[model samples]
Structure formats: C-alpha cells, structure tokens
Target: MTEPVAYSTVWHVVSIAIVFLLGLFFCVLIGRKIGIGFRFSVFLYLYHSFWCLVYFWYAGMHGSDAFAYYNQGLLGIDRIWFGSHAIVIVVSFLTSVFSLSYLGVFLFFNFLGAVGYLFFYSSLRCASIGSKKWVNYLIFSVLLLPSVSFWSSALGKDAISFLAVNLALWSALDFSRRMSLMYLAILLMLVVRPHMAGLLVMSLSVALFFDSRAGTLRKVFLGAVFTLGAVFLVPFALDYAGVKGGANIDSVMDFIDKRQSITKGESSVDISSMSFPVKLLSYAFRPMIFEATSVFGLAASFDNLILMFLFIYGICLGFWRKLNPEYGNIIFIVFYLFGAWAVLALTTTNLGIALRQKWMFSPFLIYLCLSYINQRQLGRLK
Candidate 1:
C-alpha cells in the first residue's frame, strides 16, 4: 500500500510538470504575440538561474520539514487530509520528492513562489513612478534582499505562501471583471498556505469592503471567507484538539500567558529568558550587538540601507495614495503591509529576515510612489 502510494505520487508529479511546462510554452507564445519586453525576459532568466543553483545543490535530502516527509514517503504514506484543493495534494506529494534531494526541495519552493513574483512585478509595472532607468535600478537592486534569496535557497514554506498572497491580490484587482475564474483562483491559492494566507484573506476582505460594484451574492462572499478562515485556523484548531507532531500546545499557551503577564508595558526582559522562542522575540525587536551575540539575528530591522530607503518611500506613497479618492490600490497595499507586520509580530525566529522581509514590501512602496509621481508628471504636461 505504501509503495503504491509513493509510485502514484511520482506519476502525479510528472504529469503536473508536463502540464506546467506546456502552459509556460503557451504563455510565451501569447506573450510574444503581445510583445513582451526584454527586461522581463532578463528578470525571469536571472530568477531561473538562481533557482538552477539551488536545485543542483543537494544530492541528499535536506530541509527540516523535508526530513519528516522523507521518512513518511519511504514508508509509503503520502497523503495528508485537507479540502478539495489540488495544492494540498501537490504540496504533500512534492514533500515526498523533496525528501529525496536537498536542491530539489528548494527548487520546488522557488517554482511555487515565482507565481507571486509574476503578480508583484505586474503590479509594479502598474505603479512604476520613476524613469525607465530608475525603475530598472530599483527592480534589480531590490532582488538582492537576503530573505528573497534565502527562501529560494532553502526548502522553506515562505516562498509559496508569499506567492499565494500575491495571486490573491492580483485576482482581487480583477475580481469584478471575471468573478468566477478570479474568485476560484484566489481560493485555490488561499488553500495552499492558509497559515500565512492571512495576507490574502485580509487584503481581499478590504477589497470586498470597498468593492461596491462586485454584484456577487452575499452568501457567496460570506461562505468563501468563512471557509477559508476556518482553514487558516486549522493548525491551531488541531493543536487545541491535541492532534500533534511537534508542539507542546499547553506549554505554548502557558508561555503566551506568561509573556502577557510580565510585559505590563513591553518591559521585563527576564520574561524572554523563559524559552528559546521568547529569546527570538527579544532579538526580533531589539538592536543588534553584532560582536557579542549570534542568537539575536541582526541588530535592527532592514539592514540594507538603499533597499530600506526605497521601501519607506514607497510605503509613504502608498498610504498617501490610499487616502486619496483615486486608484484605491492604497487600501490593498495598506492591508498587505499591516498583515506582514502582524505575522512577524506573532513569533520571532532569529533568521536574519525581519528587515529582509521588508524588501518585498519595497516593490509595493515603489509602485505607489511612482504612480503618484507619474500622474503629477502627466498633469504638469497637461
């Protein structure tokens, strides 16, 4: 039974790859018909090249998550329970193959993440505020953010979650225009990473709030949101039900209460000493003392100055535009930024990523900034 499961998983993977590649070919053909530019080509090529390195790295299985999966796959146990969404099955099956080689796992993660980058760059094109040269400079420079590469370089879940969020937003923009396809696409993606899918849920909720023209049935929206919200809560739900693999749910609850009890006003550093996770919380928010400690991650958030500057400028622009009556892309931007912080604030891992995650926020910031600037430029010409 186990061997059959393993074999079936492999066949499904091969079939999916063949389909995806064929789709990419069609995309390219259509893109050429529409005259896609050289810069997009170069950007994609570079993205692929980095993943190529990642894919070639491990002959042996790696990734903390992959390790658990590899053993399970070896035992011929390949399925995990979830809704009708194919992503749940795909992720599970790939976890089996990813258990085979280190590089393979990262590559798979990279591939899923590339979906989000597609929308991100598209949105950027929609919002580019600077000259072509400045846009190109911003584009290339922002890619250097460490966390961006780190996700592609490791067998981590962040890349795919990131992609799902982007697709949800991209579809949100097109929701009224094509409700069936866009809405289904958003739900399929939301299912892929419901734990971090909050960004999509939150963004779409705001999108729903402002979207008076989307004359959908009220039950449809309510049902979709409620279903996805329950899925998002599943991990916690399972923990509470005592269906566990890694967590000591009771300990976690106790720690949370303890942290709340002590930090009357975010004081009491002693509370952090209570556990490794709490220690991570301290490092996440505090200044780095580079010479003395290796555990706190970086001293402060967003260590890259140029990228940080671009991000801040972009965010300010997004907020200002969101406040304006025109092109309410600002609301989505606000929601994403707010969601990003809220997620980070949930737990602290000293992964040198606090500031780096801010880099993804950079593109959004710049897009809003450019839109405002360019509109003004056109106004001046008029």
Candidate 2:
C-alpha cells in the first residue's frame, strides 16, 4: 500500500506556492502600471519576502501579535467591516476559505506590503525626477530599511495601514485625476485607524483651501464636503483614540497623561516631562546607536541616523524656503505628516511603539526631504 501524504503538509506546500506566484504577478502588474522596470520590482518583492520570512521566524520565537490575530481568526468571530476587527475577519476568510497556514498568511501580508512599497517607490520616483545621484541613493536607502518591511510583513494592522498611507501618497501626486484612489485609500485607513483617516481628511481640506491652482468654485464645493466629513469624522476619531471628552485642551492633556502612564516597560520614557520639541525628537529619532540595547534597536538606530542626517541636510539647504504654495499636494503631505507626528509623539511613551508606528509619518518626511534635495540639484543645474 502507498503511504498517504499528510493533508496539512500538502496544504502548506500548495498555499506557499500560490502566495509566492500571486505576489510576483501583482508586483509585475503594479510595476508596469507605475513604469518601473520588471527586474527592480522583482528585486523589491524578493527583498520584502525575505523580511516576511524573518518576521515569521521572529514571531515563532517571541509569540507575537501575529499569533494572537491568527488564533482569534480560528475562533470564527463575526465579521465587522471596520477597525481592528476587519483584520481578524480577513484572517478568518483566508484560513476558512483558502486554508492558508500561518506561514501563508505572513506571505500574503508581505505581498500587500510589497504592493505598498511599489506605491511608495513610485511616489519617490515622481518627486526625485532630475535629482542628483546622491539623492537617489538616499531614497534607495530608505526603501531598503528592514524596520519598515519587517514590521509590515506579518498579520497585523501595520501592513494594511502602510498600504493605505502609500496609496494615498501616490494618489496625491496627481490629486484631481486620482481622487477615487484617494477616497479608496482613506477608506482603507479608516478601516484600520479612524484617527489617521480624520487627519488625512483635515490635511487635504486645509491644502485645498489654500491651493492657488484650484478653481474657486471647486474649492467651495470641496470645502463644504470636507467640513461635513470633519464634523462626522473628528468626533468619532477622538472617541476611538480615547479622547472621550472631546478636542478640548484639558481632554487632550488628560489623554496624553493616560497614555504615558499606561505604557510602562524597559523601552518606556518619561515623555510627560519632555518639551514639545524633545517629545517629537524622542518619538521620531531617539534610540540612536549609543542608546540601543538590542539588535533590533541597533538596526532602527542606524535608520534613524540616516533620517537625522537627511533632516539636517534639508535644513542646511534651505528646503522650506523653496516651497511653492501652488503645489497643494505638498501642502497636504506636510500638514498630514506634522499633524500625525505631533499627535503620535504626544501619545506614545514607549520607544518600541514609536519605532513601529513612526512609519505612518516618517516616510512622508523622507519624501519631502528627498524632493527638496532633488529641487536643489535641479536649481544648481539651471
């Protein structure tokens, strides 16, 4: 009698192959749409997959949130359309319908992250057009950073949020024609994090209000729409973020205090005592190499070092002085970046959380800095 192969082993092997093939197909398709070379897209997909596997191994060793999400999905929770529950629903569908193993789920999320990388890379390519060699190098360095790929590759909110942010960013490059994409991106963000969606809408509204390139009638129409959106979204977002008392100064301060007090650990800091600038710095650029206590911290520190250098370089080059008010997209991104960063910095008291969450805004800062450098290079040539 022939020996029977284990069904679990067969399922695992088939799921892995399908996920890998599907990821490559999507990568190639998105690359073609974005006008990137196939080889580069494949390289990026492979690189991101490498980090996905790394995350899988790490999760197995550490018993991470990925396992929690997977286990919850196995319970067959009733599906919800938005919030963190949506991620569990996705896991449920994948496991119940597709019979994907845990490794398969990680690969699937890794593919989503790779798609996001395509959008991110396309946005930077648009912004860096005509930039000098060094600017391109810096942009590549940012893309190659492991922290982003690693955190976003597992079954969690981070992968979906990263995709939403990048999709929004790419749509902002040509906002009028890509308004549908922007709407989709905002919807996706709302599903994961309503507060981020609220911030994105607020930023777009402010940018449109000041956009010289937009017609007055268009501005008026959008202004009303955005006002309605804000009225609905802001309160919901505040409630979700644990600011139940509303947007008053006292409420916000209370929320911040609560956040600081609750998030205690080895990586926690006394953020309540820090000045506003220091708080921002700590959230965005702390855990420098000297302060790093673990291998992961050391890696993050190196990435931060690069980011710090870019910030200083942009300032030294007077990047802010070169901003043009007509580019409403730039204005939109700047407002989004600052607003998100400020809120997160105020609420995040743990370096580990900051490390994982800063990707939500740090990429915007990086794009802005690189765009400014590219513009400087173009000016010198002219």
Candidate 3:
C-alpha cells in the first residue's frame, strides 16, 4: 500500500517558496516605478486596505482567527512582568474597554488591521516602485483574493505581525537615519516573534549588503541567522535563570508543548500540561502550517506550497541578475525573501501558514524588489 498523503506530499513546501519569489520579483519592479508620493502610492494602498477590511468581515462570517485576537490581548494584560510594544498596549487597553467580550474585541481588531495596512502602504510609498498608470491598480489584487481578504484584517497573530511588518518595510524604504521608524519596529519584533523578526532582519541585511553603503562590519548580514537561533534558546535560558516572568506564558507553553509533539499517527498530548511559554513561542515561531492552523481544522494545500517555492526562485533569479548586473534593491529583495523562506523551510513544515503572519508586508517587499529591478535598466550617464 502507498504511504499517507502527508508523507508523500512533504515536497509541497518547496513549491511555496518558489511562488513567493515570483510574486516578490514583480512587486520590486512595480515598487521602483511608482516611487513614493501622495498620488499613486496612497490610492493603491488605501484600496488594499478597503479590501482587507472586507476580508476581515468574511473571516468573521466563517468565524476564523477572530477569537484569537480577542483572547491574546487579554492574555497580554492579565500577565505581569511582561512588557508589550505600543500596539500591544493599545490592544490591551481595548480588551479592557470591551470588558473581555470576544465580539467587541473582534471589531476593534479589524479596525486596527485596516489602520495597520495603511501604515504598511505608506511605508512602501517611501520605497517607490517606479512604473505606474494602470499597473499600480493591478497590485491591489493582493487584497482582492477571497482567502487574502478573509484573513487580511481579521484578528490574531496576522494583525500583530502586519503592524510590525508595516513599520519594518517603511523603514527599509525610508530615511537613512539610524533612528528611523523601522529600527524601532525591528527592535519591537525582537521581543514579539524573535525568530521571524530575526529572519526578516537577516534577509534585509543581506539585501543591504547589496546596497553598497551598508558595509560589512557595521550592519551584520548574519544577525538574522543568529537571532533565530537565539530566539529558540532565550526562553529556556530565562526560565532556567529564575528571572521573573509572566504567569500565562509558562502555562500556555506547557499546554501547547504537551499537545504538540513530533509523534505521528498519535492523537495530540494534553493542552493543560503543555508549557505556556512553549505555546507562546509555537504560535510565534512554529513553522508547520498544518500544526498551527490545526486548531481551525484547516487543511493544507499541496499547490500553495508549490507556489511559494516558485516565488522564491523567481526572486532568486532576479538576484542572480541584480547582484552581478545592476546591484540594486532587486538583489536585496531577492536575497531577503529567499533567505527568510529558505531558513524557515529548513526549520519546519509549519512555515507555510506562519510565514503569512510576517509577510503581510510582502506587498511592500514585492515592490521593494521590483523597484530595484526596474532601476537596473536605467543608470547615470558615462
């Protein structure tokens, strides 16, 4: 008899990476041409935000991650000795304002999701895609997909990560000042989702390596790799050290860990015994799409996985062209996206869903790469 679908389909994740690459390449090209301004950039992103709002509503209809947003913020404030970023603070306050009702919080979360995308689009404008006219409208398709909308502004980890991504992408494209908004955003990510944060940090650093002005010693292309390793180790180190921490993190970790095991064909372990800290990390860094969304009874798609890999390869090919031919942001986007996805793919199969949380700013990333690619065909006079 043949093996199960999961075993036979292990190769699907590779495909996901490739699709992400192709999408990114086109994004970079578009970003460079549109450039940053009040006109084209704002209109496009606003359109995206509008669709994203509709998507959030769709998720509500099906009852998706809405509960997650409502519940996570409560977990945040209910715990002590844990410091949240500016957005988290707002979420915590809203949770209290809503008196812990899931429905009320869901509405608030979707509102923030729309606002988060606004910042994300503005950040992309700061980067500048280059080409324009009708092509700009074409990019809004990112938000037009039923699935994309269903999840776009809905509550949960996706919204949290999108806020961080918005700030990061904006900074990646903006002023050269060390204190840029992106630096703060990256710093916040350190505490939030360290692994993916590190992933993007490393990826962008690689992109910066191609920037000519970035310099080897000062910027550290290897930071993201090291950061990812550290993210895994940091919790255990802290827990072992007897440092004061949250009440829920440990309990949550225990429940999730016990429930989440490498064991195949067996039912999940007890959620109560699993460690809360581990669960927090799992929700934040766990790579298997099926495992993470298993709570929703959502199934995996072999085809989506294939698309991701194709996307990565397309971006990588752009890099092959840029690193040698033009040495622009195209190479940076290619390097960062490939590294982020490649590293995550190695870590686990869950990356398909988890990556979505962080890649909300992917629209911006696509533009960043495309902008640089477009820049290649034009240069200074001899």
Best by TM-score: 2
Give the candidate number with the greatest lDDT: 2
How big is the RMSD of model 3? Answer: 13.7
Each candidate: RMSD: 8.2, 3.9, 13.7
Q: Which ten residues in a row have the lowest lDDT in candidate 2?
A: 1-10
- CA lDDT of every candidate: 0.45, 0.82, 0.44
lDDT of 3 by residue, 160-274 (tens): 5666666665555533642256566655555445545555555555555455565666446444544554455445433432323522566534533432332212232222233
In candidate 3, position 85 carries an lDDT of 39
How displaced is residue 19 in candidate 3, in Å?
A: 36
Candidate 1 RMSD to the correct structure: 8.2
Clashes of each: 4, 0, 71
For model 2, which pairs clash?
Answer: none
On TM-score, the stronger of 2 and 3 is: 2
lDDT tens digits by residue: candidate 1, 1-382: 1111222456456654553454345434433433446456345534643643543343132324434443443445435443223333454465555432323433455555554555555555544434456665665555544435544333344454555555544444455453453455445444544434444455656656555554578646754774576456645533442335523677556544543444433322332334554443343333323322432123233334444465456444443532332334456566665555444443323333343344334444445555555444345311
Name the 10 consecutive residues with the lowest summed lDDT in model 3.
Answer: 1-10
Candidate 1: Cα lDDT at 274: 43
